[model samples]
Target: MTRSAIELPVTADDRRIARLAALAIGLTLAEAAIPSPIPGVKPGLANIVILLVLLQYGWRAAAWVSVLRLLAGGLLLGSLFAPGFWLAAAGALVSLSVLGLARHLPDRYFGPVSLSVLAAFGHIGGQLALAGIWLLPAAALLKLLPVFAAAALIFGAVNGVIVARLLAGPVSSGRQSGSCTPPSIP
Candidate 1:
């Protein structure tokens, strides 16, 4: 694969975004250490960082952070270009798109939790769809949708709560919402 070259130097904001991506990547690695009863059922702890980035820096920064985490985490886990990476990339893309749309909703009607839930469902849906089209390609895979949805709902709510709490903190809101500030890491 050909890589693109950057003509400009990395800015302070880029460093901050890299720090956020590193945090998400760390969580992804740690989550990988835990065993799940179901193959695709994981709490998605790294999502908290993505959701936080979304609320603070908008969908563009969140997209960057999510992609960085996936690439870095996949490489670290030796899952790059594997089936898992394709599933993860699809999920991340869907989740980012969901966040992009959800962010436009009135603040009074929906917040991080709602947005998180939407992204979570989108994430799982994307993975399931990809699995159906590529990996399994069987009607039996459809049976797992409900299970994945349940996991997404539960884990999404938990992650949403964590992100909401982070947003509630003074450090993450106000003047620093659009820029990276040293907020307390959860």
Candidate 2:
């Protein structure tokens, strides 16, 4: 869908937001390229953008940006239907949901770190759920929860810090400018 079709106001600010999303997609792809100890696990650095969009633009913008990132990233990487793609898609959906819910809470209530924790846990849970459905038995998947959780915690916190840094300036400026209000705290 075109930018105008998304119901977001077509001001310069909206264009700026779109540009930011594109940048986030690029960042995510770069993050994905970094080798990890486990093949499929990632730091989910791009999720900071997703969280920021959800906070600044609203869920619809966040969701659409996420879908765009997933599709574009998969196509660019040539991993559209690969197992990793499915895992990433599931994780993204879960992370988006968590961020959506978190948006309801006052910004000061949770902080970026806490939101990242929730998103990371949701991301890992989604992957585990997919694994159970498409490959392993539930019992087998359960065996890996500890490992996944640990990775999620570490990566999630890292992503959260990055996001917090990125948002601190823009969000505060937006608030001061009366361009937006902090989302309600859940």
lDDT tens readout by residue for model 2, 1-186: 656655644876557566766867898779877988875677887788877777667788778778888888888888998998898899889988888888788867788888888999998888888989998898977878888899899988988887666654454534633434443212
TM-score of each: 0.86, 0.79
Question: Which pairs of residues clash in candidate 2, taking residues 3 or more apart in a chain or in different chains?
Answer: 104-184, 104-186, 105-184, 105-185, 105-186, 106-184, 106-185
Instruction: Give lDDT: candidate 1, residue 139.
Output: 76
- The ten-residue window of minimal lDDT in model 1 covers 173-182
In order, candidate lDDTs are 0.86, 0.79
Off by over 4 Å in 1: 1-7, 170-186
Q: Mark the regions of model 2 whose C-alpha exceeds 4 Å error after superposition.
A: 1-14, 170-186
**In model 2, what is the error at residue 123, expressed in angstroms?**
1.0
**What's model 1's TM-score?**
0.86
For residues 63-173, what per-residue lDDT tens digits would candidate 1 score against the true structure? 889999999999999999999999999999988888898888898878878888899999998888889898885677778878988899999998988887676556543
- Could you tell me how far off, in angstroms, the CA of residue 94 lies in candidate 2 after the best superposition? 1.6
Candidate 2 local accuracy as lDDT?
Answer: 0.79
Which of the numbered candidates is closest to the native, going by highest lDDT?
A: 1
